[model samples]
Structures are given as structure tokens and as C-alpha cells.
Target: MQPALFAELRRLYAAADVAGDAVQLPLLDATATARALLIEFPQASDWPSVGATLSYLADELALPRPALSVSAGGAFTLWLAFASPRPLPQLAAFFDGLRVACLSDLPADRLRCHPLSGLATVPVVPAFDAVVERWSAFIDPGMGSMFISEPGLEFPPNSERQAEMLAALRAIDDRQFARVMAQLPTPPQAAMDALPLAGHFTDPAAFLLAVMNDAAVPIGERINAASALLVAGRR
Candidate 1:
């Protein structure tokens, strides 16, 4: 994280005035502090610690639960993402263990988790449910459909998976896919209007190309595409 950015977040959290129960104060303070740090920190491995801290604080404050994710890369460059359902104090303890596993000095090994060579499945817990629910909320329902579900969890996909999904869409029978796409509900006009590219694609090919070729498009547009694919795939 950039020093200036971190400092600014610290200031923002510090400046917030309390207007609730005194018991809420410490938890609120901790949540703000952890959130600020998490937002500022780019390293995915560090997320557990920050998430755990914030979760602990949130619990203490009796605040409505929020979701969290800890994603990392593997030996062959495969990505891994995990989430928790509701914030739990145990996650903080788990974060402590993750911290030890991720040594401070090593960059590549830091926070890295991967699938074992012999293992065909990745491990997951109930917490990931909350993560998926919250993540889905952030995305359009169309995009949210792209999320893949395991026995216990759902997650936003990585770039490679996104590419593969796009490829699959290309391979699908066009008329059938179009019919399916038609059934998908249109997203909010506000979200669609916010982007110049969305709500304007008359053809699936154009939509796919816009998603693949347009690096300059806003992040929200990309998110929309992902969500749209999720919804489109369902059909």
C-alpha cells in the first residue's frame, strides 16, 4: 500500500465521531482500523489477518455481519479464493496461523495457498457462503450468474476462468444463446447508463468483443460483463 493512501484512510477512520453505545466504540474503532488497513493493503495473503481483526471487531460491536475473501495464487499460477459466511472470532485465530505460514521476508510464498497435486478438490468452509452472497450483491444479477458453486461456497472468478467462460459462450450455438440471453432480466438503468458500452450491444458478438478487447473500459463495465456472463450462462 502507498504510504499516503494508508495515511489518508487512517485519518478518515480516526475522524469518525461516535453516536452509539459506549460498548460499540471499541468494536467500531477496530472495524474501521481493520477495514482501512485491508483496503490499503494489496497483498491478498494479508487479507486473513485484516479480515479476522475486522470480523472480531464487528462481532464485538454486534454489527450486522459482512463477508470477506482471502485469495491467493498457487505453484502453477492457479488462483485460489475463499470466504467466510458470517464474521467469526475463530477466523482471527486462523489468520494468525496464516500469518506464520506466510513469512514476512518472502514475497512469492507470502499468503500463498494452492491445490495439492493429488487432490482433485479444493477445501472450503461455510464462511465462503457469506462471501459469495456479498460479492453477488456488489455485481449485477446477470454478472452474478457467472459465479461457480462448490458444495459449500461460491466465488468471483479469476481472469483465466473468465476467459474460459467467454470462450464457452463463443462456442455455444448462437440462436440458442441469444434466446437464453433474452430471458435474463436487464440490470438497473442507472448501472447500465453509467457505462457507455452497456445496454447498447445489439449482438452477442459485439458484447463479447467489447468485454475482451476493451481494456480502457471502466472497471464497472468489466464487472457488468462478468455478471452478465454469469446470468447468461444460467440460461
Candidate 2:
């Protein structure tokens, strides 16, 4: 096993917040001269499509075709082992093109890449099982589930506050509800408008629920909405 490659993969797994034992090492090809790159996604629906697209991309770019595998976790592992050493530029270009191809088909936030082995001059036995054992041991179950919650992001609607706001809104008539909504700040107004519910929700609580759950909405707007809800509830 290449120590440097293992270290890099370890770092990437942590940075990407990959779920429990989600990392997969690149498998050695028939000649055992090269190891493949690993790519993972959050969902399984697109894995086969991505694999096909990658194969097409490799042919179009005149790059080495990668051996593709799928994991239960919905990751697509692409292997492109070379029997002989290749130029760094050649490898870099291939990976770059692969990245672009993936981005064109999937959301950028859902993709991750991990380099398992460096360019090799000679065939080396890929330590796939060993790598898996090491990673399985390295993962901490206590760490909890992985998600995209960034630091400093303030999400709206903690259970207690949301309940209070909902209760308050429920007590109001439509005229009063409209008045309270009108008093909401511009940022929350914009956020609410961006939601699919927007003006369509008959209940204020449901509208807030939609705003709270949308990951695409700005955090500030969500917070603003929560605050507005609290203030409106008081009225």
C-alpha cells in the first residue's frame, strides 16, 4: 500500500464527511500496473448513468477507459490502470475531463474524488482489502451521520420555537395572518417567495415548514422567517 495515497484518501474522507465506511480503494487491473480513481455520490439513482457517461467521456477524450464498479453506498469506482508510467499532464487532463463530465450530469455538491495510488512505473499489488480494513477501523460510529450543514449557518425552526409560532399562527384569522406576513422583513419575503409554497400555502405553519426544509434557500432568510414567525406569534 502506498502510505501517501492512503493518507490523502483518509484526509478526503474526513473533509467530505463520507458516511460510515463509505471509502473504497481502487482495484488493481489485470496487469496490476495501475489503480483506479474512486468517485462517490449521495444517491444511487444516477450511478449507472454516470458510469456510462464516464465511459463515453474516456473514449471521446482518448483517455484510458476505466473499469467501473458500484457499491451499496451508491459510489462509482472508476479504474484506469496503466502498465507503464504516464506523464503527469496526461493523467491530470484525464481526471479533469472526468470531473467536467460528472459535473455536467450531476450536482457539484454530490460528487467526491479520491486518488488511491500514484502513477506507477511498475505494477504493484493493490492492497484493497487492507485499505478497507484500515478505513473501517478508522471510521468513528460516535461521530453521527454526515450532512452539508456548514459552520455558522443558522437554521430556522427548532421544535419548541416552531411549535410556538405555529400555535400563534393557527389562532389568527386570515386577515391577521396576512398582516403578520406583510410585516416579515424583505429577506424572509424573498426566501418565502423562492419556495414552491410562496403564496400558495393556506396555513402559515405549513409555509414555515417548507421554508425551513429547503436546503437551497439562504440560511439568513430561514433565520429571518423564524424570527418573523416568533414576532407574529406574539401579535
Candidate 3:
């Protein structure tokens, strides 16, 4: 599973499109290749998409920052490792949820989520694309967009830099993953109450829907309701 985390980055390069729409997803129960998770965006048209997506994860989801890799092609990738192997089906859904939620503008067809197996194309490994004769490796995000036009490098990235990038990469623990998984998108339903969210509901949105729409639930109570939604949101 460990080796497959790197392999998944290569897989993202080949299988770059996985989502169908913004609201409802037909997530593939893609089995795992490793103990890691790599959420890639093949539909990222500009460098800002990369920045926005990263910011959403950091600021909104409060997830551990993932390593970013520029592919042999023009697509960008986000790689996250786990302290333990995660079930591929749940992992797939979790990742697809993030893609749909954070990258809301991405069309249904152009998105890619899961990482499958590919030989020797792992990020930071400096694989040579024979067709284009350029290299692929982990890059500093501050300077990542500059490489987006032509992701492959003419020469090998400095080994020490690559080493530093790899070293800086952090893995998600079970508790951290579980907390975020509580917020990932679920299959659409008629009402938020239908979801098995906190205890009875599958959705925290239902709590908001109930409190926000009810006139009897006063303004001060409404403010408290919004604050309470955080606890309701957790699994």
C-alpha cells in the first residue's frame, strides 16, 4: 500500500476524469492501491484552480496539506498518505466528495478522483516521458503554476529539493480523516433529514434547514443554531 501511494499519483495522470456533476456523484467504489489517498484535478484549467482548491482544503476543511505534483501532461495532483491503509470504496467516495465540493466549477466529465496503478511515474521520481522527453516531479507551489503550461521538466529536478518536498509531506491519521469524512457529499435526497448525519440525520444541513427556516426559532436562537450546527455536523 505504501508504494501504491506513489503509484496512485501516476494513476491520476492516466485516469483523470471521474465525476459526473456538481450535486450528485456516481462515485466508483475504486479499490485501493495503497494506504494513501491522492485527489487529482484533471479539469483544472488555470493555476488559480490549484490555489483555490488548496485554500478550500486548508481553510474550510482544515485538512493536512498534501504534496502537489505536476504531471507529464498538464494536469495537477494532490497526494495524501495515511497512517494506515484505508478501504478503497470509502476512500474513493471521500475523495470524490472533496473534488465535487471544493472544485464546484469542474464539470461532471472532466474530473478525476481515484489513483490506480502505473509503473515508474510516481511524483518526485522524475520519470521521463519518451514522447515529450520531459520530466515530472514535485514542485514548489509558489512556483508550480509556472510549470503548468508545460508540466514536464527539461532536466531532472534537484534531488535534494525533491527529497525536501517528500520529507515535508504529511499523512492523515484516522481521526483527522474521520472528521472530514463526516462532511463529504452524499447521494442526493429529498430532504437533509433523510441523511444519517448526527444520530438520526445523515446531514447537518437538515439542522440548518430546520432552524434557519423556522420563524419561531428567534434570531438569538438562530445564532445559537448556527453555532450548534458545528457539533451537529460532526459524526
lDDT of each: 0.30, 0.37, 0.55
Winner on TM-score between 2 and 3 is 3
| Residue range 1-235, candidate 3, lDDT tens digits | 1344334333322222322221111122233234555556564365677788788788887877777777667677676666555554456456556655766675534444443211212333446677878776777778777875666688866766665566666667779889888877753334323422233545667766666445333223343454466457675
Q: Positional deviation of 130 in candidate 3, in angstroms?
A: 1.4
List clash counts for every candidate, in order: 10, 1, 10
Ranking by TM-score: 3, 2, 1
RMSD of 1: 23.1
Name the runs in model 1 displaced over 4 angstroms: 1-201
- Residue pairs with colliding backbones in model 3 are 1-34, 17-111, 18-111, 20-108, 195-201, 195-202, 196-201, 196-202, 197-201, 197-202
- Answer with 2 or 3, whichever has the higher lDDT: 3
TM-score of each: 0.19, 0.31, 0.61
| Over 4 Å off, model 2 | 1-35, 62-65, 86-90, 116-235
Per residue, candidate 2 scores C-alpha lDDT tens digits across 122-232 of 111121233223111111112112211211112221334322322221112235323423442333354335654345788877777676455454333444455456568
